[model samples]
Target: MSVLIQYYNDFISRSADPRVKQWVFMDNPLPTLAIIAVYLLLVLKILPLYMKNRKPFNLTRIIRLYNIFQVVACILLIYMYLTAGWIQGEYSIGCAPVDWSNKPNALRMVGTFYWLYCLKGVELVETIFFALRKKFNQISGLHVYHHSSTFFLTWIGCKFVGGGMASVPSMLNSFIHVLMYTYYYMSSLGPEWQKKLRPWKPRLTICQMIQFTILIIHSLSAFHPECDIPKYFMLLYLPNLVLIFKMFYDFYKDSYKSKSASLNHHQREKKIS
Candidate 1:
């Protein structure tokens, strides 16, 4: 372990910049692919057993557990974010701008990034539970895509983008998770309670879209003369986000339209019958 740490430190030292070092780490490709493989295997193995039992999906318990996990994880992430500032000798949240390429700070950032990446892996349990409960309809393409992509993206961020423009999206994502998780906790009880609270699911989706947009813009900004990010990777990053945003928007619109149409159809059928 000590030798591995020394090797990582030496590699970080020799790299041109934090982003370059991160890219090297992401270039490994093996760990992320392995995770996806395990996720698929687990889903295949458990889904049939869940179907055979015919158990009703238990939303309440799932929500409670999810809420607990998010609340705790959010708190811990916030603490780490603050500590990173302290390590940089910045006493306040608004102190000196963070230098993403600074070695000590970059190392700390990578460590936190790893924590967040592992959290994404842990979150796979959400999908597994859904599969087990036979709530397959809820497991849409967006759902699976987001889960799988986030795991890989977080891995890439930790390994290749930990200290550069890419970190902005990561930091924003953590903040959003705080809000998203709290909303989930409140909405978990039942429809009656959710009606009273009137939580904004659309707003959450909008926030997510905004986050991706910011990330894309930030990646582009690295093209300026002083920025160190390679042109090739920057070019690669932008188009993927465009596709991601379009997919999320379409999913949002379709979901609302489908729900409304279902309600209208139900009313019409009642009148005709």
Candidate 2:
């Protein structure tokens, strides 16, 4: 296992950007592409099998496992981040690089990113569960697009962008997932648990929005003279963020609008009766 980890690490390190010795550990294009391919294939193949049977998919086990996995992963990442800081005697609060070529720090960042990248693959199972349960309507274009795009973009980020700026998003995302997965796990317990946890979904969405906004700002800050990061990469990061923000906003509006309208209709009927 250690050897395999080392090999993976070496593979990513070699693909690091030439200019900055800050190696991109999660950036390997081949593996990412392969993973995406496998995901698509699985979706195509398995979805139909489930559909034919017309059976409800019990996601209790998967959700429980996912919840545990994310919590543990988040803890490990936080520990890694802190350990790296302590060892190097360098730390920054937000998304700023302490130094580029700090190997241990870079490796830790890479490992975290690697897990996150794998998590994207694991997340594909969500769609599968939805499909199996025959909740096809829930599988929106936004759902598919976000899942697919993130897998590729994260790979790109790991490949092209490394160090403090890149690690910031991963760290924040992991923290959010810890909460998000926990909510999912509890809600999976059944309807009784769901009512008590009803408020959590909005909070999760809020946190997600906040995280993206912070990431956008952090990426933008790279253009500052004092920061001295590449301009092209920063520019690339901004437009994607803008699009993501817009998408999330649209989703929130649409989701709430429908619910609000339904409630209003119900109230009008009650008043008339």
Q: How many residue pairs clash in each candidate at the backbone level?
A: 3, 0
Estimate, for each residue in 154-240, the C-alpha lDDT of model 1 and write its tens digit: 776566555444555666777888888888788877798688666387778888888888777666666777656655545656776
lDDT of 2 at 56: 75
* Candidate 1 worst ten-residue window by lDDT: 90-99
Q: Give the winner by TM-score.
A: 2
Candidate 2, 58-116: lDDT as tens digits: 76787688778878877777667556553465646444653456476666665555556
Model 2 alpha-carbon miss at residue 186, Å:
0.4
**Top lDDT hit:** 2
Q: What TM-score quantifies how close candidate 2 is to the native fold? A: 0.79
